[model samples]
Target chain A: MFEHTENINNEEYIPETYIPTAVSHGTKELWQVFWILLGITVVDFIIYFAMGASMTRNIIFILMGLVKAFFIVGTFMHLKFERQFMILMIVLPALAFIGMLVFGLLHEGNALSIDY
Target chain B: MSTHTTVTNTTPTWAGGRSPFNVSYGKLMMWIFLLSDAFTFSSLLVGYGAIRFSYSGHPVTPWPDPALVFNHFPGFHGVHLPLLFVSLMTLILIISSVTMVLAVEAGHRKDNKSVLKYMLITIIFGSMFLGCQAWEWSQFIGEGARLNENLFGFTTEAAAKAGNLKLFDHVHWDMAADRTPGPVPFASLFFIVTGFHGFHVFSGIVILVVVYINALFGTYERRGHYEMIEKVGLYWHFVDLVWVFVFTFYYLI
Candidate 1:
């Protein structure tokens, strides 16, 4: 229960550490992102059944997954509102690591395919 | 210090007091942690992919068909539903993430009532997803799948040749023990990857429950900013995003 107080100058009363400066994402924007994510996921579910198994389907699934990941990180995680430097700091290293894994796996596959 | 003489009034470079990213220390650290965690997951998934693609076409036991393997829907009683339940679980997780973001938005507006309400909703949704996951795991184990063997008949040489393996047939439960200790990477990888992700979901639920209790106690109200909620929101979204990858590799692929 919060105490009721008159319009007293509470500047000195409030603790410095208690300052609230979180960026306000509008309610409408939040809902918009939510809908976008749900729609994409539904489409993803549908595509699996529609396309069955194929190299193309696998590629499409990966691309669509990246798209969904982008939306979740950009909107729900609030990465879009963050500064460019911060975004680069996170995204660049992650991409680099993923690239390394992909290329490394490809090389391994090539070696495995060759019979002695 | 007493002997030091001031040259310029400007702040020292070493001090660098301001946040380089214009964000709080807690948030910056959370991002770093998530990035490292992302690498860990990527490595595991990539390793699974490598092993699977290499051996899928080989004469050895083929990778198990995810559709045939995970076709159990709760309470449907022997009904075969390929990916219907997992997709529903994904949707629930995404919905929980939406509620989490809404809670952060409410916190930004300093609307304590809305924040608490949204946080509670998010926690409920997260709990539901975990419940579905537990049921799915139980079905898999009950069907005789384990780390040692792929219970699915198609994952064995003889069954692959016979080509008449029914999904979730109780008769084949003994067939798992009959098969030689062939390459069952599918079973091992399925358990490892999903197990790790399940652990994350479990921990996320625990953290969300704690956050919900704090919200009920009006702790965030006193703190003036629900940065804690925002941080947890980052984690929840990451979990949701990771599931996208898991669903793609484990189910769709």
Candidate 2:
């Protein structure tokens, strides 16, 4: 919410400007992200071992993985403060690749036997 | 003529650090390079997935059970080690990334000593991870895990010593029996591809060590910037990103 984009720069001078020795977030917010990551990873384990159809489980896991991946990319990678153009530059290609994977998956099932 | 003098003396060749890309010169290039490398790794993992499924079933098989096949060590005479080694590698990479960040910070502060110290730490970490990967490769190659075929599937495991083996044929689950193991071609492929990636980590470690040596000699200090640290950090993080896909495809799925 308190995102600032002006810090993105190409300054040539090597100055130690605004280096916070112990920069940290409030416990509540930090813990929220931590728990979310933990919860998703746990869900990943479950969807994997949940003993459902492999196709269904695969979808679930992929979606969960993407969710976790975005949280990590946006928050941990510090892309939240970036401008919209920068955000799209970083994310859109990955999304395009994911789209290809989904399409490939649809056709890939032909490679496997569908035993009921 | 007079204007030429003014332009040469007054106009700045450098934009004083402005770019239409809206990111630092080093950082933006890093992002693009990482993006390209991401596709390379993605294609490798996904191609493996496609081929593995394509041969989901064939005649003469002891289908590779990832759980049983990828057993790595946490200790001696490993009692069916899980993907713990991969996790350890991940931890090492993450810690190195942290150290690299510290190095970058030190570079900004012109703290040459701290920069060298942290970069050295990072190089050590990258080498350690590479060592771990080499051990994993040895285990894979040793004991002769081979690409096998059976009635239902083709998999990586020890092939039949003398007879034509078929799918679902009964063999001892333990490695002690039927020890006529040979090099699995698929296993070799896996080792080569992943091994080369590990080699890159090794290469990066060596480069970092060189950079540390240079930092000790006041190269960056005299040059007046630590942009090299940022560039190397990019290379390091790209390595980590590649592993994320490798984990999901190789270990989990």
Candidate 3:
């Protein structure tokens, strides 16, 4: 139920409910991302068997997980095409909060183990 | 009306009358919602890490190794296939994500036929993943993993034997000989984290079905935009994103 009106200056004026037209952007990039994600997953599987359980292996898995998150959020969710401000608004807060929680609580857990 | 000016590179992003994110109100809200959801999941995972770490030096019942506990595979009875079945589940979720993006891409072109097709495929794969989770949970429960207790703990002898076992070897659990009660939080956290992620997948499937029905009736076609698909697509992708972390923290580590 959007009202269509012509501005006096002949410029298209987008109203509050304005939804810009959807464009196809083709499926090429989507497929490329799919392949890259699958490839990294395969690497994850291989490394799991190839390496012993150690902090190094665990760090590798966490780093690869972050890389996968980049693709899924950037391309699959279409955040990469959004405005710069929007990207920072979503990404920065998450990194800060999650990072702090993980490191802080894990240190606490390690201390609890020592006391036991 | 005459005061309105065309948006250009020099225009201040926060100026009124337009979306600073260049997304519709609904899609932007979906992103915000997902950001909040991410925080919720992070808390659960971080808590899990803390509890697990605290169990490291328990003299009576050391923390159970995940490989020994989650080694069963369908049709391969007693085989020690750690990480294999969950790996299959990961593949299913990732493939379904691809189909969902394809559905959104089809929506972009206003191709309702292709949209419905891809949507159906995505829903099917989503359900398939749920089925796998159901089986995995049944196996865990059958082995006496409960929210209040963990029966997967091994005696020193059994733990030594488990360390020497190779892939594809038969894994027989002798409750009396091998298992003692384990850290209570291990079983509890497993259920809470995976259960939460599973519930999200279930809800995502329900939402996708509703979106698919709407498209079948030409709702998006009549509305002149397929942004609904895009919005729901964002939610579905968010589900997949959460699974990546769950798979990493819960299973792989």
Candidate 4:
């Protein structure tokens, strides 16, 4: 059998600079994500005028922002196509930290408002 | 060497001979950097939220309504046009992101000409977004939105008038009569968060320009890969992602 492992010992085998060949996944999915994002932004614009500023409205806007973020990160950044471990490594910690900050600090802020 | 050969056909992903994530080292590092950047932005946003919430019931200097402060659009002075210019800016950034991803896709195909074309388009749109931000900042500052103090605290009379305002309704803002000193942190946070975001967009454009020049010189073609385009594309899209939240929390909410 051909010895493929021997190439690792070769002088050309520089692990630090190793770059895997990239493949074109075409632009179809990218365009779809773009439209979804644009559509959501439009909806956000319409909703702002249609509804008064309230907690529900703000929650809706935030949810839509997350949806837009999903498309941007998953497709535009190609994180969706990456290995599962890579996705988990980047996503899990961010979710945990951001969630903690939002809940914890907002609660504290609410307490401060009560005292004020 | 014999054991290595035996494992070659079924090499585990973590066997140390390859990238387990299956991405280039540069791309992996870019993701890590972006993750850190995300945290920085999150902290800023959370801070803004906390500060704004703390001023909820201030009798003298209430947190200003964004609609009153951000209602001006270019060529329509004295008109109530909330969310119009910012929506345009958001669209610009989104379209630029699309073009950037297109450039990366072109790079994947090794189509240097197409890549250059798309990169130029992305740069133009990015610069347009930056210009919009500059105009918005100027409008804010021109209306007395200082970092140390806010001038958007409308009197009860002005608040009543503002409540009746529909889009594009022309109304003069007599700053001296209409408003008082308001929450200091409102203006400061606005400048800090959006300024940081605008700076990111600016740097992304500069990076895009450098990459465009490199592509013009056939640098990636000579290297037999276009991962550099992918790396920059990640940064550009990250800027867009940040803008999405900024629009939501700063304007809509």
Better of 3 and 4 by lDDT: 4
User: What DockQ results do all the predictions give, each relative to the true complex?
Assistant: 0.28, 0.12, 0.43, 0.47
Q: For model 4, what is the alpha-carbon lDDT of residue B143?
A: 86
TM-score of chain B of each: 0.84, 0.75, 0.95, 0.95
C-alpha positional error of residue B8 in candidate 4 after TM-score superposition, expressed in Å: 7.3
Top DockQ model: 4
Q: Model 1, B1-253: lDDT tens per residue?
A: 2444434324332344333455677787889999998998999999898878766655555566687678777777655567788889988988898899998888888788998899888888988988888898888777667898765544354555434444344333345554443347777888898889888888888988898889889998887778888889888889998999998899888
lDDT of 2 by residue, B20-50 (tens): 3345555666778777777776666666666
Off by over 4 Å in 3: A1-16, B1-11
lDDT (tens digit, per residue) of candidate 1 on A4-114: 222222222322233326768597887887788788878888887787578999999899899989988998899988867789999999998899999999776666551
Q: Per-candidate interface C-alpha RMSD?
A: 10.4, 9.8, 5.5, 4.8
**CA-lDDT, candidates in order:** 0.77, 0.59, 0.88, 0.89
Error of 4 at B78 (Å): 0.9
lDDT of 3 at B104: 98
What is the lDDT for B21 in model 1? 57
lDDT of 2 at A6: 34
- Tell me the spans in candidate 2 whose CA falls farther than 4 Å from its real position: A1-82, A108-116, B1-18, B57-59, B145-189
Q: Which candidate, 2 or 4, would have the higher TM-score against the true structure?
A: 4
Docking class of 2: incorrect
| lDDT at position B232, candidate 2 | 77
Interface RMSD of 3: 5.5
